[model samples]
Target: MIRRLARFRQRFGIAGRKVAVRTELAWYWRWLGILVILAAAFALAAWMYETGRRFAGFDQRELQQQIRELERQNGRVRDELKGTREELESLRAATAASESRLAIERSAQHKLAQQIKLLERENARLREELATFESLLASEARVSKPLSIHRLTVQPDVLPGEYRYRLLLLTGTGRREQQFQGRLELVVSLTEGGKDAMMVIPEATGDAAPAFRLSFKYFHRVEGSFRVSPKAKVKGVQVRVYEGKAAQARATADATIE
Candidate 1:
């Protein structure tokens, strides 16, 4: 009986077995608790990350604001530059228009001056012609010669070595019954290379010979041009008129060049 009692005590003794006390929970409640702990850890990590960024002087909101302000400034500068370019173009256009108008005005003025000069020359020529007619009417004596030359002139033309000549031919009262058929000749006296020289216009057998043929009655005006060596200095010119098949000149006039 003692043995049996000892065996029972041993089986129930604390040294032989330790007992655990636990409260039973549902599976859902256990999962809920785990999720709550995870959420708290995530919140703490986010807070720490934000705090570190601030410590490092990297404020995202301020940086974004500065970028927007710079964009606005850039837009304003672009607008001003565009306006300046437009104004420059406008000024250039205005300047071009002004220059064009000035050129036109200058051209008109030049043309007006040229017309005035032509009118003045015409007036002088008319006055001289009127005086010649009046003198012819006043003369009582008839000319002895059948053909006579008057008012012969030789002058330098615009170009070098070019000369222009003009003359008036008057037929005597008896010669006016028939038209005078003749030819004109020019004797140009010049100095070249320190030597005296003479040249004849409308050289023999030249194409220009046709232009020297003359046909007129009463009074006739003769005008023509000739060219010579540019290096030569002209001294004097003489004009001669020849009738058909005549070897000698019928009329002659002399003019000195200055």
Candidate 2:
């Protein structure tokens, strides 16, 4: 019986040792699991920090580029504004100069118009005086006792070679007159005892005044022998306007060689 009790005690001691070893192993396993979870959490936090830093750098670069573009745009806008101001200034100056020129021209034209008006008034006055004198002469019912002229001078100093003598006879009331009925008569005799006489140059028909109009406008072509005279007192020009028996000569132009 004693021997059996000894064996039972040995067995109990071995079983108690086994249970203590198992408890130690369970505590070690629990500590290892806690360490692995802590390591995983730390690694995740580091990765998150790196990723956030990279993202912040990218955002900063983009913001800097946008700022540069805005600054460039501002500079361009300023330059454009300056150019527009200069253009406006030039336009203003041109406009002012044009207005000044226009004003000066207008002033000059006003003065010219005033002078023209005065000259017109003077011309009208002279015309009125001439009309008055003609009316006075016409009112006097003087008998048309053929007006007559004895001598007429064409030129005191004559030029050399074959010269021309245009005789002009002007008379009558100032109006477009066509009062001539017959032919004109004139005896052109030179101081050299040479007589060159002609009634009128027939080809000068267009030059004749409209009918009886008082005008001495006529063209006469006389050649050398009759006109080229060096004689001291050249020719006596006689112009008779009316052709009737009662002869009235308006005037005559005579030439003298000095």
Worst 10 residues of 1 by lDDT: 136-145
Residue runs of model 2 more than 4 Å from their true location after superposition = 1-58, 132-258
- State the lDDT at 253 in candidate 1: 90
* Residue pairs of candidate 1 with colliding backbone atoms: none
Minimal lDDT window, size 10, model 2: 217-226
> How accurate locally is residue 115 in candidate 2, as Cα lDDT from 0 to 100?
91
Off by over 4 Å in 1: 1-59, 141-145, 158-160, 173-178, 193-195, 206-208
Q: For model 1, what is the C-alpha lDDT against the true structure?
A: 0.87
lDDT of 2 by residue, 200-239 (tens): 4222454444332342322111212223345423445455
Across residues 1-258, which tens digit of lDDT does each residue of candidate 1 receive? 999988888889765577799999999999999999999999999888877887887767777898999999999999999999999999999999999999999999999999999999988986997788567645643356788888899999999999999988888777768899988899999999999999987786633377798888888888889999999999999999998768799999999999
The whole-model lDDT of each prediction reads 0.87, 0.52
Cα-lDDT of candidate 2: 0.52
